[model samples]
Target: MKKSPLYLSILSVFLIAAPFILTARYTQHVLIVVLLYVALGSAWNILGGFAGQLSLGHAAFFGIGAYTAAIIASKTAFSPWWALIAGPAAVLPVALLVGWICFRLRGPYFTLATIAVGEVVRLIALNWTTLTGGAVGVVIRPSLLSGTSKLPYYYVVLVIAVVTVTLCHLMSRRKLGYYLMAIREDEETAESIGIDTTSYKLRALALSAALTAMAGAFYANYFLFVDTTTVLPLALSVEIVLIAIIGGLGTVAGPVLGAVLLKLSSEIFRNEFAQANLLIYGALLVLVILFMPDGLMGGFRRLFGVGARKSQRVSA
Candidate 1:
């Protein structure tokens, strides 16, 4: 299929001038958060969207990355840059082990196992006082670039977001994506068709965990703080899942669009409605699930009839 010229042009323009376009410090800060969620959402989609593996333990991996980076850097004088690589590397083995154990289960049983794994990780972070700094949380001095400046952080996160999206795009166009989709549709059928369902599923989980963990490492360094409540919380995992679902689970751009819209809407609600923001957010989520299950991007595609004909062709 030919790529969309308009989409490519817009992307190029945005990448070239995002810094100039976002002049306000507050705007830049919000953009950073949006980009972070966008990356995280895309990462989650690898497993949930591509492989049909529902993981409720992503925040556990996220926290593992953050804490690993923080502790290694703080204790050994290693660059946080190095920690970013190390943190995700540390998470890969754990994700593989978990995948190996839980891939035998299907549906909700697997999902429940993931949730339990997350809780176990969170409990460890909360109780391991000497290693994780316990409930007090580890605080690092601000970066030499200073964490307060939004511009530098914005560019840094923007680069990461670009890389993340590119990786997702590449993966989605490859054989791995086809295998994942086959598994998502029917694991048994996929296996019958000569796909190594177990190994592919494990690969999906590992890649998802590694990417999410890298985001966590960046969050720790950018925010200069790591706490179990913020990093390892179950709520964080839920948010990741929500973004991916609400954006259009299986599509490449769905999670990115979902993150931007949700984050922006939530921010607006927080600023204007304050105490009532949660109510509004909850209501919005319910509405989206009920009426727009395929999400904003999905709706857009449907409205334009770009993919509808293809879908119809397949169905026919």
Candidate 2:
């Protein structure tokens, strides 16, 4: 059974009112984080979940986007808003190149290739001082959030999050998404059916890179800085995949659900006990993976049997 339209409506209404209700900067910041992860997780879901291309190199795209914007902002007079578009544009070719190189392998090889590529990119960014500022990082001259409450930035991210979800929803109903699913389910079979698996996977990677770049642009502008370690870290890439896994792979609402629950919990734990956040996160992840391997959404739907499921041959 699909989620009730009324339930979804209520949830949307609540989310819309949350920023207004919670006036504190920190609380609002946490909410913003939830939205941020919602986008990040969803973006990763496109390639990793829907297409079954477990990329551990997404941070490469993310770092490219952030560095693109940061470099532009530091060297020129372009607005940060331009970074939104430029970020994705810059990463698209890079993503296509990476896909061309990495799509040759299958299964664990692909995953390992992604990890290696991500490390290579990070190392390059760390050493490329003239362009990326090396370990020193690039700082924006004027902050996007300067003289503004977190509210404006909150809405900006919310709009982007909405766009990301809407695009996923639309894509799920279309031919490209179906091709991706076919490839995911069985690549050889998909190839036998005349689907160009390599091309489709490349397309998915390109789109995923674009979306990730958008998020990276926002993150860099919001934070007013970008560094190789911070933007291109292996942990960030792993976090993207984990968020999707924790929710529900191949399900549209899975990433959102995972991001909300996981990011919120982490933030709360960090606030309460900063030093133990990783320990808590690791323990929670292990418990969840052990008990609910299908992720929070899959577990919930399995129990309740009343939500939109990707297995029903429906939207992602």
Candidate 3:
């Protein structure tokens, strides 16, 4: 039933050979964006899908990671590569603090708290001209991969995507994944059964935060720039959630598939529709939600009658 290993192995080969095969800068750029979203969406799934804590403000942690890398690069002589570690290190405490405060509330209240926290952080970055450079943003003095090829950036994000998804797959088969799923299904019953819902939720958030920050760090490095508008936008968070949901929530492959479909389609729409792309994109997403409420993966399963036993096993 668990065929992720074969799928991931094939995916890895395709990703590794993508730049060489595509050759076009634009195509490679799109691939990079897809991989980046794969990382972001998958990270969010840990908290939102697995733990059933929908956070609309994940951009907060993402921005923090971007800033961490940008700030360090601006101030110190250290290579920008250091941010892969520093970004997550900086984000961990802030993520824990936010979780500690917000996890006290449940359902929509918790969701609202996350949104507020994300906005507050964005405001801080916007107003604090001294550290974050205000609207001008911080530019990485020395970019990790110099040149316009985009191939290097592709591999960097691909690595992040692979690591994040692999971790998610592993976690889903472990005790933590079961606990988080239990919490998602029924918090009261989970608590009654002696599961520390808050603790597990916090752990999920922490893991999500770290992985999200890693993607943020990659974003900053690849772009050689960092700004609140670019990294801390509510729209970015919404896109992340949509990626997971449209692909299939609580599944490792969902985000990757969602990212591919969404990004490629958006690119096509932009090229073809030009002025009406956004409207069309919005309409399409609405249609997908209405017709396939459980997402593409769920639809596939229902249509083919595949993975039914696995689904029942996991649910039970």
What overall lDDT goes with each candidate model? 0.85, 0.87, 0.88
Q: Tell me the spans in candidate 1 whose CA falls farther than 4 Å from its real position.
A: 1-4, 309-316
Q: Which of the two, 1 or 3, has more TM-score?
A: 3
Give the alpha carbon lDDT tens digit for every residue of 91-160 in model 1.
9989998898888889899999999989999999999898889999998666655655677777777777
Please give each candidate's TM-score: 0.94, 0.94, 0.95
The stretch of ten residues in a row with the least summed lDDT in candidate 1 is 307-316
Per-model tally of clashing residue pairs: 0, 1, 0
lDDT string, candidate 2, 199-250, tens digits: 9999889988999999888888788889987899999999989899999887
What is the Cα-based lDDT of residue 290 in candidate 2? 89
lDDT tens per residue, model 3, 125-222: 99999999999999887564867678888988998998999888778878888899999999999999999998999999999999999999888888
The TM-score between candidate 3 and the true structure equals 0.95
TM-score result, candidate 1: 0.94
lDDT of 1 at 248: 85
Residue-level lDDT for 238 in candidate 1:
96
RMSD of each: 2.7, 2.4, 2.1
